[model samples]
Target: MRTHYRFGHEWQVQARPDAVRALLEDVAGYGAWWPGLRVLADASTPSRRAARLEVRAPLGYRIRFTLTESSVDRHELRALLRGDLEGWCMWRVVATRGGSRVVFAQEVEARSRLLRLASPLLHHRLAGQHAALLGAAADGMRRALADGEGAPGQRVGAP
Candidate 1:
């Protein structure tokens, strides 16, 4: 049986909602602020984009997922995933006093047999690794935005 996982995170970013939204909308630029992720995007219009992502998990695993980003509004991004993972992910960003409050939510089923078999035993470890990764990504985003990176008209981070 496949193991289904639901992960969510709430992060505080040092940027306004618009700035955060612009960063979030630029899906191709995520590697600059997100750790262990490399994204390749194919798009003809703003409403939808097809992307392939390669992620290096902390446990020495490489996860490859192909997804289609369906919508990106002023403060939200929604996507459907396939390949190694199957399900959906969403992000919501709201303006706060000194920055933005962001919510990242994902519900996915492990399609890899190794992961499915080991999930029950390594659940805690997996969760811990994911938490650490998300924490680091949050810190990276804070620094990137604070330094005026990832925002439109601002300099982009190195490849």
Candidate 2:
């Protein structure tokens, strides 16, 4: 059986909603701000792309997945995943008193033999690792936005 996982995270950034949405909408641009993320194939539109991501925790590995569906509009963003992992991930961005609040959620089934086999015993550990990875990314985002790195005019298509 495949190992299924679900997780959610919320973080606030001191950036405008449009700025945050612009940053998140550009999947190919992730490698510029998000750590350990690499896009393998850039989609012509803002709606889809194929990527390889590696996370280093107590356990480390890489997975290749195609983001077959994506939507980035005024209020939210979402992506459907396939390949080494299969499921859906989404983000909702809202304006807050100080900045923007981003809510992110994801559900996926592990397709790799190693992950699927060890998941029963290490699922919690895996989840923790995922959370930590996201936490780091959030921190990176705060810095990038403050530095005006993810602003408009960045090259966002095809790596």
Candidate 3:
């Protein structure tokens, strides 16, 4: 069974690249805009560039990982993950016709022995859940950007 998953989710928005980058870099602001999403600081992990974030989906499962290396620039926010999952995740922003295109890409391998072993049976379920989560995030961002307030708690965009 394959234990690694590569997910690429893309969307185009009327917002500019900088606007989208700002929203993506504000991980702490995610819960406010993204429905069923929660970002909590992981005090156990230390980082100067950004907070060590533990993200939880509405279903109560937490994505356990720490950013070992990361960088945020005008067009991209990329991070290398380590913990229960090991891999890299990136949010790439680029100018499009009238707005910007945002692509979220992640390549991760299950570090947990049990999860790795169960990949064959559980992979589809895992992918479906992540897709739903990403879809909600995209919808939330679209609303927040449309409202001109993408910051956390600025406006309720929960589904």
Candidate 4:
């Protein structure tokens, strides 16, 4: 049997689809807007990427995952999980009337028994965090599109 764990959030970004897609593809920019994500390793190139990340939620832990695949189709950018987590995290950008609708979805399997046992509780918290992170991303994208630089708000590094 296959076990499934998923969490996602949708937000309207005041930017074009291209702009939103650019920001999503730029993994290094994640630490600037995505809270609780401490970027341990940066994405080397536009094609292949990997990072050692310290995630605070779902029982504080660190995992180094390689971005096995990252590609854009029209407006959506898909990222496949490798190394630490076995799953997929996708970002969909749809053109709306005024801007772009962005959705962040992650479907991952528990890598350990502890993670599996805490799945129910962690799911709820992760859902909330995802929503918040998306909101922040939207704001950052808006600013970047307006100023020509994807400048994200200051974030303190993980201790």
Candidate 5:
């Protein structure tokens, strides 16, 4: 029998909540800041509130996901997986005294029986990869903030 699991982590960045949100919305820059993954495609809706992104893992495994139900006021974003894996990935940003706290979580199930059987091993690897990627994002955000590279008028705290 296969089991489903949830993995999540929280990261603190020296950037305001709105700035962090904007940085995330910058699809083109994700590959620059994000550690391992590479963006394959970025399509935004007319409103630009929703987007579809195709990405590949560090090892070059491709995954396409759609981000929908975006709510900036709430500082949260949701994504549905469309390729390779089938599930949901979400990010919730909360404003903090100095900057912001970001929570990243994902719920996924294999699309095939073979993948399901391999989940135990893949889950462990994925968890580690996720942590590293989050760390990289945090580091990149910090560096970008230090250099004042984000949206204009948005000031980030000192590192």
Candidate 6:
């Protein structure tokens, strides 16, 4: 059995796109900010940056994936996700009146049979957990950017 998942999340960062991109590109430090996110490897460079990340929910299911950069744009970063999950994820950052608008979109399917089978009852919870994690990440980024790079902002979109 296979279960497909598509997620779209957007939030406001009280910083410039460059600051936000800098934080996002430094994937190795995700664990220091984003809870439960572990970066197994960081293959970032001055021109292109990406990483292999392990995502675990409180439900104890682990999804490991590598994000390989697939785009060459400055304001947008797209990645081909490969590993326990298969799909693509992207980050688009644009300047907003106050700061920057960050949009994150991901689509992937579960490779674990147990996870696929449990999706019917657990999808909502899983999405909620994902939302909370990103929300916290946004908060962390704001705090990190508080030193004149940015401030704090609110999270939009839904679970």
Top candidate on lDDT is 1
Model 6 off-target regions past 4 Å?
43-48, 150-159
Local accuracy of candidate 5 as per-residue lDDT tens digits, 44-78: 67665444555545645555555543444467877
| Candidate 5 or 1, higher TM-score | 1
3 or 5, greater by lDDT: 3
Model 2 stretches with alpha carbons more than 4 Å out: 45-58, 148-159
* TM-score-based ranking: 1, 2, 6, 3, 5, 4
Residue 109 miss distance in model 6 (angstroms): 0.9
Worst 10 residues of 4 by lDDT: 150-159
Clashes of each: 0, 0, 0, 0, 0, 0
For candidate 5, the 10 contiguous residues with the lowest summed lDDT are 150-159
In TM-score terms, which candidate is top? 1
Q: Which is superior by lDDT, 1 or 6?
A: 1
| Clash pairs, model 5 backbone | none
Prediction RMSDs, each to the true structure: 4.0, 4.8, 5.3, 6.8, 3.9, 6.1
Q: Where does candidate 6 have its weakest 10-residue lDDT segment?
A: 150-159
Give the least accurate 10-residue stretch of model 2, judged by summed lDDT.
150-159
* Candidate 1 local lDDT, residue 106: 87
The 10-residue segment with the lowest total lDDT in model 3: 150-159
Query: Which candidate would rank higher by lDDT, 2 or 6?
Result: 6
lDDT of each: 0.76, 0.74, 0.73, 0.63, 0.65, 0.76
Residue 158, model 4: lDDT of 16
- lDDT string for model 4 (65-152, tens) is 6554466678677777765467888888888876678887888776655555555666666456546655665676566665533223
Instruction: Give the C-alpha miss distance for residue 26 in model 1, angstroms.
Output: 1.3
